[model samples]
Target: MRPSVSKPPACLLLALTSIFLNAQTTSQPVISADARTVQLERRLETISSALVAARQQVDQSLQQIHELQQELAEIKQQLPSAQTVPPNSSSSIADPLAALKTSVTDVQERQDTLEAQVKLHDQTKVESDSKYPIHLSGLVLFNAFANRGNVDNIDLPAIAISQPDGASGGSLGAGLRQTILGIEGSGPRIAGARTSANVNMDFFAGLAYANFGTSAGIVRMRTASINLDWPKDSVQAGLVGPLISPLSPTSYATVAEPGMAWAGNLWTWAPQLRYAHQFPLQEDKHVQFEFGLWDTPSSGYNTSDVLRSPSPSEQSRQPAYETRVSYGTSSVDRGLQVGLGGYYSRQHYPYNNNDSWAATVDWRVPLGARFEFSGEGYRGRSLGGLGGGVYKDVLYGTNPVTGAPAFVGLNAIGGWAQFKSHFTQSFEANAATGQDNGFADDFHSIILPSTATSLQLRARNRMIVGNLIYRPKTYLIFSPEYRRIWTWPIYGQGNTADVFTLSMGYQF
Candidate 1:
């Protein structure tokens, strides 16, 4: 019976198998549809990427085209006009494609050329703006001064007597006190040596109530010198002004009294040879020494003909010999400077004998800005021999009152102190005392004497001076001054003169 029931078992099994195969076949179509959807998504992504890349390429191409067009325009402007172009056959000129190619090539070449030219121009500008060592500079000074009371007459003869007393009120005058032009240059060594030089001149004119009429004018050599610099050394030579004196180091200030023996009497010019050597005392610290040979006499009673007279004999003779020494510290904070100098000259005139010595001390105190003080003392002696003595007695002495030596020795001592305080940026003041012996009495005896022989009565005299200077800027200065003079050995009785002066100076 089981066999009969199972007779369909195999067939039943086959039927089950067939049902499974049909189900599997039906699932394949759905799987294929999903695969097609994925492929379509991938293709869309690829197309989007390609579109973005194409847009970027188009933008870059447009930028290049814009630049090329600008270059083409510039090249056209530089091309020759019809007047410069040679006539050609119509067939040759009709080839627009070749002409366009040629124009494009030319524009490219011109753009490259212009870029190179701009670079060259920039390089040239940089070179021209570089700093050089050569320099040209100058200074001009305009001065105006007025005097109240008696002013010393510089135009009178050196032997003239009597101070002029007229028109004591006021006067107007103008002058170029220091008209200097010069050139300076420095550079690396050439042929193992360095060289430099400076040349200057002064053209001056002024008006005063004097014998030279209402105006006095002159042109003089201010400075002429050449300097040679070695590794740490230098040498200079020429007709140079004195290196001494703080006020009148370059040129004499002729506005002051003439005969008084301070800065005025110390004024003179001479030829000199000078040498300087610098040595390092420490790192960034140095000390210098200078020595000079000033043309002058050795000693005795001989005069300098070049200074006193222009005669050939005088021109060749020396005037005097002057020596100077100075020492300075490397540290400005140390505030120390000391110097000593002297001169000895033979009498230029028969009875004139001259010898002078001076010492100076200057100190500075470190404060907010700085405070400075300096003092100088000088002494001089003039000897009058027998002939001078007789001249003095006859001119100044009463007849037969007593027996006296005709000649006498005249001695003078002078001192001055200067103090400056730099308290603020806008203001500074300087006060000085310039007084000497033999300023007034010599004037009365020699200038305003009652008799001709009164010239012999010249003796030691004194002048007291005070000055206050205000400097608002580096190039502008205003000074007001006062002077009092006292003469000794009264000839026409003791005479004194009080002088007040105001001076304004501008420089650029």
Candidate 2:
């Protein structure tokens, strides 16, 4: 206990000295909240000094009380009886002990109050530094489904164009495969530019996911990117959406429907490096010019066997190039945006050559506060690498000219439009339609033998979708959608299927 009294005073004295030194070291005449912060520091210094002085006085008083207690104990030991003791001696001891107890209580109370104030001050400092803080965002999704007709690979199956005459039945299942996780951060400065970064992933991809059922799913990368900007120019690099299709419709049924991918929606994500510069027209209004170079989409290795078709990577001889010019009144809600873009890429063939390209116009116009219209349209050849043309790049068959197999290129036209209405802050509805049509004549142009009539190629895909969204809170959403798809393949007349979907999600 004696050592404890000395230790508290010594530690508090050290703290007071350190606080005083900190106050002296800060000489800036910074103003606003900074000035207030300095003022608070100086006040803390004063409080620390008072705490040290009071602790020292308490230590001294405690030492005096200890001495008195020893004296009183000796007095009691020597006393023959209470009646024989001198009245003033006994009274004096009792009086001072009572006062010492009061003094100790007062010191304890004062120390507690000062410590609380210091804690509050520290908390205030932490809050002030917390501006531009990092936050976590993404969602946990649970989906339950029953299909009247079988679809392509399952995890989040897309509409399969297989002829209805096939032996496939139907399926029923539930899963958390669409659950997502992502981290978001901002307020970093880089090379004299403002920088922000985000990374997102989900268990919706992998070889295992191709047959994901009640089994656990494998994780897949969704987005890993960074954006750095100056006042008028910006740079972005990562796995990102192509500028050929700049608008996307909101849908909770993304996993199953893909919003409108195989239809008129040219949707694809690839690694790319992009730069954007803006010409200011007025306040919050500008014309933005963007140019980007994307990784050469590979159409895997090619083989002479026509049965073993080339993968996307094998089709590319060089990286894809794209540029877009768009004008916008603002980027906020109810704003208007319109752009025209183009894409080009060269393809490599064994002792042969092919080229692919696209030209498109994309736009969004808000009819009013509650209604909007948006879409993109493009014409591209061998664009299957970008999720168009039903994933078809070329038609392979016998060549009458060379008396060998030939790879004939294919072309397609695609576009998707979404009309949306927001009836309230918590509820909205969307209707969208799109189509990807392969050139029928181009498919017929392939020099195939009369005996090679078994090729069943897709000629067209069409989709019409309508959905309603209900958001009960900022973090929770519920949506149900109905999608109708019609597909035409050279093998049969056409195949049609209807997909109904419901999804629940919570974002943080």
Candidate 3:
């Protein structure tokens, strides 16, 4: 004879199916790709809670079954030894006990099903050729924008410029070049330190400018690093931003170059080897020191797209040096912090050698639970490659007396600050402003070359931005942003432009 079988209740079956579907289809928004792990942890917690409740109900049922069996045994013992139960009475007593056993078996099957689900979830990981595990994360971002005046790069403008003859005066467009993709992995620990690596890329290298140029963006590497992290020290080597200028205003609308690229944010990524050490303090506070050697590029110079050439800094045959010291809460994502940093490089030019240097200060202060302030400021010369001095490292012209080419490193001071309000976990607002000013004295008596671009003579650039980001669903984001830029040329009237953008993104 076939053995009896029990099926799960319709409600329980439906709940399990829903959970599986949710895990496969739903995700949470994270500040960065690394935060994907946090979202996964939250999902696991929810499932664990459900499993615990079901187990508790099964335990109670088992206890009641035991009590019933005990009572039946006692009643049987009280009867006379020769007494025989009637068929009908025996049927009534045994049927209920058999039913109780079946119920317990059903609950046990449900528990087994839940355990299998958790095991399956744990096994759902990216398969790698190597023994180590790998994970994939990314953001698919779409941006629609409208510009009310002439500006450089219509989709991702950095500066306002004077309108030329027959100019359209404005433009409306959309694109997906800001989308980012990343891959991360972990390796075996060595010398009491954990090892990890990640690489990020986007389609922001350049545009095709063809019939479907907006849809055809070139792929480019954003940043990549291999890190060894100890409890109080770390080492990183890869392409990254300058060590002296680490803080940048947060804005999804400006992911290609960050919130303030040419207008004050010194964020040109370069290959570097860096080391950091931390000193623990009371509570959550700590002090850190960081140093790095970077392969800085030369700004205000053109390079061939088809051939490789050494930049002025590279021609110097020496790497740039940078160092920073900061004190703050140990949290890397957010908290209170203040940092001071410095950068130095030697640039070899055809005419002469120039010393490129900067002093920088950055800060992040929490005003309360819902608000925070962050900013970075710097004073430097010959910093155009690092996004300063109005994108000009040095001004060149004919010397009046000697009739020989002369070059002078451009001096500039600029910074950006932002005020952020986190009204809730799923919504926030931000306002920020930045400026990059090249001193007028640095531009005097210099005759711009005929081959120079219109922006080569730019003396100053200022920008203001405001935006609201809302997350209606866990992994969906919608943001609307406004930006205004004012730019002044060395010998011409200043120009202005206003930009409005709507950005939508899905994270996974």
Candidate whose lDDT is highest: 3
Candidate with the larger lDDT of 2 and 3: 3
Task: Give the per-residue lDDT digits (tens) of candidate 1, residues 176-269.
Answer: 5434555555545655668666665555334434766443445456556777778767777866644343222111123322223332234334
Q: What is candidate 3's lDDT per residue for 1-508, written digit by digit as tens?
A: 2333334566678989999988766553334555777779898999999899999999998888786566555434533342655767866586666645655565566668789858865894677776786878899999999999999898799989889899999999999999999999999999999999999999998876776535668999999999999998999999899988888997888998888998889999989999999999999899999999999877746568778688899989999999999999967767899999999999999858999999999999999888999999999999998989998898887676787777889999999999999876678899999999998887776666766666678899999999999886557999999999999988768999999999999987
lDDT of each: 0.47, 0.74, 0.87
Question: What would the per-residue lDDT of candidate 2 be over residues 1-508, giving only the tens digit for each residue?
Answer: 5677788888999999999988876654444669799889999999999999999999999998787566555544434343544766877676656645655565566678689868864563222253654546678887766665556644355555453466556666667777888866677687889988777888866436344435456788876788998998999998877866777767777752357877777767778899999899978789999999876453324454348564444455467899999999857556899999999887777787778788989889999888999888999888776777766767787666666877777888998899999877677899999888888877666664555422237778888889998886556889887777777775557767667778888876
TM-score of each: 0.51, 0.68, 0.76
Off by over 4 Å in 1: 1-139, 153-194, 205-216, 230-232, 243-265, 278-289, 296-319, 330-335, 346-368, 382-410, 438-502
TM-score of candidate 3 versus the correct structure, residues matched by position:
0.76
lDDT of 2 at 263: 79
Regarding TM-score, does 2 or 3 come out ahead?
Answer: 3
Deviation in Å, model 3, residue 445 alpha carbon: 5.0
Q: What is the lDDT of residue 143 in candidate 3?
A: 94
